[model samples]
Target: MADKRYTTEFFLTAAEVNSQREMPLSRLVTTIIDTATAHANKLGIGFDRMISEGISWVLSRLTIDIAESPSVNRTYRMTTWIENVNRLFSDRNFEMTDAETGRIVIRAHSTWMAVNMSTRRPGDLTPIWKGFDMVDGAPSGIDNGGKLLPLSGSDFEMSYRFAVSDIDVNRHVTTRRYIDLITDLWPLETYDSMRISRFEVAFKHEARYGETATASRMAHAESPETATAQIAVADTPCCIARLHFSER
Candidate 1:
């Protein structure tokens, strides 16, 4: 039988890096998502196949820890596999390592649900689960809790208008795009002086094209290096995230 895990290599382009010459959090997320999508396609459970059946995979929660960020034009290998699956959701794991030195750069875990595209209701994944090899490894050491509470108050808030480019095959704002919007709330100086050690986000609702969404952030009083962001469209919440930073 073929191994249940999949691995792929990526070379970061100039556009994927920030002024600090390292991969930005948002772009790193996009790479992870892309790697997972490619792995799913190899397993015959990818986005194209799912959408054709009126089912679309929605990311419910994600958590990532970065030990190091690869620089522009550097190559890295991403390995992903299914850690477990239930009727309503599946837990996936990912690891990015230096292609040459074999040092691990990032570890991540994500929870996803398959939903009926038209009804927007969770769909049973039992049929597809039968074909997967259900691995017993979670390199990220993060729980797939899928819980993110809204921030009660914020120090700053920003609103953004979604563009056509933000929409994905599911006809909603892409997960990577949402992360980009959330991280954009921080100024360049923040990125220069601090590094994001951990990031957690929960997707609550879907934002469609041309919708206006607001993002708000509040630093934790107890843990000054930690903060939370709430993203909403109109009055409906879309995503809530927690970011942990450290001096670089």
Candidate 2:
């Protein structure tokens, strides 16, 4: 039973966005991660168990396809589940929808590896799989196409002053918080109608609480019918965010 499913709801706040009053893409992704983690905890398959058993899950890759953006005050629902666990890694799937219309706004595919806590490196997943059961068939028909925004050029520029709340147990701004900042730059309407089909971000430098950091984006691709964004920091690039939109 390594696979589990979950759902959650939360408010979209201004502090979660930039001047355009939209929820940052980074924040949205963070919420999804947290919600999924909480769901696993509720089912007794939490992170604590994984770590204590000499194994922990690490997000090796993530691909988010956004079809629509959630606006402030709007109620949104998120559903997540484990697709499958292999000898070395596991695949997780996520779906986001507008609570009101039930229209899917986002979808994601993430690859995870179980690591040995003592060794601080990847470990075999066989022991981890023995504790869990397959929920059902694997996630089918998910489009694995698209790319994140290039973290370069002058088309976009911004930054954030990390607050006390931004710090995690690791003493650095968490990965999800960074994703929130990037998503916040898109327009509400654009966010609502677009679905992120691919989102891949990696952590390099760590930003401490109360420290200021700038964010920048490059136009990887744009058109009246579709758009993609690439986000980064000053000189050092952090992640690439690709957003696929639906025409209004």
Candidate 3:
């Protein structure tokens, strides 16, 4: 067969929303990854197949930029595709639109590293790329994801006990749930006091479902206005997350 491009569609539901009653940004990321994986699977190139080969796709970093919030009962369309492949990582981009107006609501950019499951380290993606066809154009360069939190320790430390439902098809905690768990650790007072202006995260390791995650905040003395947070399972750092809050 000839090289080809792929895309998939998914709908959002009320259960995915956050306290503000809009679809949670983290859930949006989850949908994107799920759709992209499905597209890859249509070509016989997906995470499960890679895992069977002793390899797995690890989301190393991601950015999600939201323009408007979707209300309950509204159906949205999500599309994802492989934008390009770097030396060791493949870049994936996603777009979400209001199904009725065709207005864009959110966009996301993510980088995934193919790693050897046995060694638990970065591995060449060439083997994986061979299984799928390449797209023709470069990724749309728009910075769709949220900004990274500044280097500061003023952020507070939070903790969450994982639930069984957090597990994905891979039998590990789903990436979206981790975002929820991390953000949930933030004090209710903080959300009431400020608005999250931007957020960024880098996933370094996977936490199995039912594990406990301790999230701690770190602030930069030089710039107390900026802060970052780190979430870990026991002593192993699972994710490095940063959130910027604009004073209300």
Number of the top-ranking candidate, with lDDT as the measure: 1
TM-score attained by model 2 = 0.70
- Model 3 scores worst on lDDT over the 10 consecutive residues at 146-155
Evaluate residue 108 in candidate 2 and report its C-alpha lDDT on the 0 to 100 scale.
Answer: 77
lDDT at 92, model 3: 79
> Which of 1 and 3 is the better model by TM-score?
1
Q: Over the stretch 1-248, how does candidate 3's per-residue lDDT look in tens digits? A: 53354545445566766566666657766676777777777757687678777877778887665566655667788777678886578887777788888998767678888888788777777776665466545564566444444333434676777788888777888877777766676666766665555556888777887789887777556765445777788777787776656565
The local distance difference test score of model 2 is 0.65
Q: Give the TM-score of candidate 1.
A: 0.92
Best by TM-score: 1
Q: What TM-score does candidate 3 get on C-alpha atoms?
A: 0.78
Per-candidate TM vs. native? 0.92, 0.70, 0.78
**C-alpha-based local distance difference test score of model 3:** 0.70
**Cα lDDT tens digits for candidate 1, 169-205:** 6688987778887888899899889888889988899
Model 2 is weakest, by summed lDDT over 10 consecutive residues, at 224-233
The total number of steric clashes, by the backbone 3 Å criterion, in model 1 comes to 0
lDDT, candidate 2, at 220: 42
Kindly report which residue stretches of model 3 are placed more than 4 angstroms away from their true locations once superposed: 1-11, 144-152, 163-171, 187-197, 209-211, 218-227, 244-248
Q: Taking the tens digit of each residue's C-alpha lDDT, what string does model 2 give over 1-248?
A: 33356788766766665444556666766776787678668766578878778887666567777666567767788888878778887777888888888898778777777778788667887865675664444582466554443454545567688888878986867786677776665556654555444455544445677766666554544343333443344555545555444444
lDDT-wise, the better of 1 and 2 is: 1
